[model samples]
Target: MAIFTIDDVEKTFKSGDVSEKILKGVDLALNEGEITALVGPSGSGKSTILTIAAGLQKATGGQVLFEGKDMTQMSQEEIRKIRSSEFGFVFQSSHLVPFLTVEDQLLLMLDVAETKLNKKQQKQEVSKVLDLVGMSHRKDAYPSSLSGGEKQRVAIARAIIHQPKMLFADEPTASLDSKRSKEVMEIIRNLTKTLKITTLMVTHDEEMLPYADRIVMMKDGLIE
Candidate 1:
C-alpha cells in the first residue's frame, strides 16, 4: 500500500469576516523510500499541505490516509501517538533545543515508553544515527557551535533516529549556501533510500529538484 494518500483534501481559513480558501481539493500520495518534492512560488500553500499531512492542521474537507488509516477520524491522543511513532519532521530551521547536545537531541526521539536500552545501548543508537548523518564527530557539541549545514544534518538525524515510516521537511535547504544545500539534499535522499522512509520536502529552489524522485508543483494551492 502507498505510505500516504491525500484524497481531495481542502483547507479554508477565516480572517475577521473574510473567508479565504487555501488548499482547494488537492490530491497526492507519498510512496515508501522515495523523495517527493513539493515546489511552488510563494503563497501556493505548499507549507499548508505539509502541515495537514503532518496532522498539525485539520483539512476542511476530504481525507488524509496514513498507512491506509484515515487521519481525519483519529482522536487527538491517537493522532499524537501516530505522529510520534509513524512520522518524523525536519524544518528549514534546525529547531534544536538550545540546552541539549546533538546526541541528546536525537535520543529524545527514540521509543522512550517501551525502550529496553540502557544508557550504553542508547548511546550506541545515537552513535549509529550520528554516523549516518556524518555528524558523529560533533555529537557532543551544542547547536550554537555547529554550522548551518551541520545543524541541518543533526535535525535530519533526529527525525530519522526513531526509524519513522514517513518524514516531512519544509524548506530544509533555505538557510544554506548552494554547495551546502546540495550536500544536505544528497544526504537526505541517500538516507531516505537506505532506511526506506517516505520523504516529502517543500522547496522553491529549482536546483534541488534533481534530487527528488517526483516533483509535485503547486499553484494557488492546487497541484499543477
Candidate 2:
C-alpha cells in the first residue's frame, strides 16, 4: 500500500455567504522511502495540501489515507495521535524553543510524541539523528547560540528524532544563504535516504530539484 494517498480532496473556506474554493478535486500519493518535491508559484495550494494531509485541517470533501486508513473520519484526538507518532514537520523557520538547549528540544518531542523509545533508547536514538544532521557537537548548546544553519540542522534532528515514517517540510531553506541552503539540502537528502523516510517538501528553489526523486507541480488549485 502507498504510504499516503489523497483521493479527490477539496478544501473551501466560507466567508459569510460566499465560499472560496482553494483546492479542487486533488489527488496525490506518496510511496515509502522516496523524496518528493511539491513545487509551485505563490498561492498554488501547496501548503494547503500539506496541512490537510497532515491532518491540521479537514478536507471539505474527500479522503486522506495514510497506510490505507482514512484520516477524514477519525476524531481530532486520533488524528493528533497519528501525527505525533507517524509524521514529522519542518518549516521555513527552525521554530526551536528559545529557552531550551538543542538536546532538550529533541528530547521533548520524543517524550510527548513517541512511545516506542524509552529514556535510554530515546537518548541514543536522538544522538544518532543529531550526528546524521551534523549537529552532534552542538547538542548541548542553546538555540540562541547557534547560527542559522546550525539551528536548522537542530530542527531537522528534532523532527527525525522519533524516527517518523513521513516528513513534511515547507520552505525549509527559505531563511538560509545560497551556500547554507545547498548544505542544508544535501543533509536533508542524505538523511532521508539513510533512514528511508518518505518526505514531501514545498520549495521555490529550482536549484534543489535534482535532489528530489520526483517533482510534483501545483498551480492555483490544481497539480499541473
Candidate 3:
C-alpha cells in the first residue's frame, strides 16, 4: 500500500514583482517499506517536493496525503505535532549537536517527539537504534570526534530512534565521499526494509539510485 501520496502538488515563490513556480502539479506516491528516490538536476524542484511532503513547507495547491489524511489542510500546530511524531528527516549534513554524545542525540529526538517511553525504556530504545545503525560502539563519542561516515550513521540512528512511519532525506550523502555515501545508503536501505518504514529521499547522486526501490525523475518543475 502507498503510505504517502502527493497529488497535483504545486509550489511557487515570489520576489518583488517577479514570480517563479518551483513545482507544477507534480504527482507521486511512496509505498510502504520502500525507498523512493527523487532525482533531478539543480532546478528540478525535488527538494521542494520533499520539504512539502514532510510538512516543512506549505504547497501552493493540491494534497499531501499521509495515511489517508491531508497534510496541506492541517493547522500549524497539527503539522508540527505530526512532524515531531510521525516523520523523520536526514539532511546532507549530519547536523548533530556539537557537544552531545552519540547516545544523547537519540535521547533528544525521543524528547522532542514526546515519546511515551519511560527513562529506562528510552535508553534501551536508543541503544537498539544505535545498534541497528552500527554505531553502538561509538555511543559515547561526541560528533566532533566521529568520522564523516560515523556521524552520518549517528544521524540516521537519531532519525529512526522514535520509529517514525516516514523518513524524508534530502541529499543525505552529498557531503560524504563515495565509499561513505555507499555505506550510508546501505544502512538507510536495510533499516527501511527491516523496520518497514516508507522513505522519500531527494538525491542528485546517480550512485545512490541503485539503493532505491523506485526512482522518480523530475524536470522543469514536473515529474518527467
Best by lDDT: 3
Backbone clash total, candidate 3: 0
Q: Runs in model 3 with CA error above 4 Å?
A: none
RMSD of every prediction: 1.3, 1.2, 0.8
Question: Candidate 3: global Cα-lDDT?
Answer: 0.94
lDDT of each: 0.91, 0.89, 0.94
Tens-place lDDT digits, model 2, residues 109-200 = 99878577778987887788888888889888999999999999888887777778999998999999988988988988988898888998
Question: Which regions of candidate 2 are displaced past 4 Å?
Answer: none
Candidate 1: segments with Cα more than 4 A from true spot: 111-116
TM-score of each: 0.96, 0.96, 0.98
Steric overlap count per candidate: 0, 0, 0
- Enumerate residue pairs that collide in model 1: none
The residue-by-residue lDDT of candidate 3 on 1-224, one tens digit each, is 89899999999999999999999999998899999999999999999999999999999999999999999999999999999999999999999999999999999999999999999999999989998888889999999999989999998988888889999999999999999999999999999899898999999999999999999999999999
Worst 10 residues of 2 by lDDT: 111-120
**For residues 1-224, what per-residue lDDT tens digits would candidate 1 score against the true structure?**
47899999999998999989999999998888988999999999999999999999899999999989999898988888888887889999999988999988878777542346777888898999899889999989999999999999999998888788999999999999999999999899988999999998999999999999999999998999
